[model samples]
Target: MHSDKAIITCAITGVLTDPGQHPVPVTPEELAREARRACDAGASVVHLHFRRQEPGKGHLPSWDPQLARDCVQALRAACPGLIINQSTGVVGPDCQGPIDCLRATRPEMAACNAGSLNYLKVRSDGAWAWPPTLFDNPPAKVKEFIDAMAETGTLPEFECFDLGIVRCVQMYRQTGMYQGLPEYNFVFGVASGMPADPDLLPILLRLKIPQAPWQATL
Candidate 1:
């Protein structure tokens, strides 16, 4: 079925970008203002990544439950009816922080990284931009996150960093790990993951679970 409507989701502040150098919002007030602007510009949803609120630490990510609560509350007040898709991307299996935040905020949606990726980047001069790290999201970890989301009544948007991960999300649906139609989020543009190319969309659509809603993040 065809329609004229599109659901736009705005990511206000991404993770790890220095607030000093970039215009990333670091405080509750700043997040509220940015979210309001996004809603004003026709975005019905906002993807959020909470950051450290302390002085000189705005570049760092924070999973503090209270901080997450404050940010979510601020955004809700600023943008009425805005769907909050909270980021739950962490580096390892120890994900109590994200779980706590999920319980604390009870957001409408949350990201469930479907698989692992070698989070890496290279500088122009054949040098490493940052040390190679693994964004580990093993099966057990993924289950843990989905369970948390189920408890909090938050929908999980499976973030697929690779084609295999996309299939994994499909398996998740078949096995009844996540109920209902899966929301696939195809992630591209990473040096170690899928490239940001529109040509890949056909293959992805063919591979994804039938009739499931999906989006691309580049």
Candidate 2:
């Protein structure tokens, strides 16, 4: 069993949650409030994903570095010593948004999905889920993210949704694409991806490269 004394991280907000529909905060003020709440609840870290502050775009993700900086500043002010973990997952070849955010915010940590996956879901009627999208994280894309994160001295929190992605981290390590100790976030429980069972934790742990620090976020 893992130690009970491990540090807890509260995910203050996500990228695509509609602020009007869910309790996820969107603005800097709301994010600061949630960060304070999490700290009071004994969380030592906060994972963040900014959303556009406009009305219709409130549900979509934001890649604006200024907005990201403002949100990080607000959270830091709220929780004087909380660790910040920024999200940097983006599709397509353009990584400038995420790169700019990292350079602007200079967060302590950030997420980098290790591999591509068909981010699919199925309806009750057996139809495609949400139009059958692809959360692409090709090797080249992964390298691009790593290079950017390295420039900011930020730790890459490898978000692996599948077992194959976990192995990809090892390959990245072998190629010297990612320096220092590799860290992983085993993101399970997605509808089409790996199941969220503690039973599989051991298997995932076994696949971890030697001397790497790893954790799970289910």
Pairs in steric clash, model 1 = none
Q: Give a tens-digit lDDT track for model 1, residues 1-218.
A: 78768789898897688889999899999999999999999999999999998999998889999999999999999888999999999997799999999999999999999999999999999998899999999989999999999999999999998999999997887888888998999998989999999999999999998899998887
Residue 152 shift from truth in candidate 2, angstroms: 0.6
Residue pairs with backbone atoms closer than 3 Å in model 2 (clashes):
121-129
Model 1 misses residue 209 by how many Å? 0.5
Per lDDT, the best of the predicted structures is: 1
Which stretch of 10 consecutive residues in model 2 shows the poorest summed lDDT? 12-21
Listed in order, each prediction's TM-score against the native is: 0.97, 0.95
Best by TM-score: 1
Whole-model lDDT for model 1 versus the true structure?
0.93
Clashes of 2: 1
Model 2 over residues 6-64: C-alpha lDDT tens digits?
77888877647777888888899999999999999999989999899988677788999
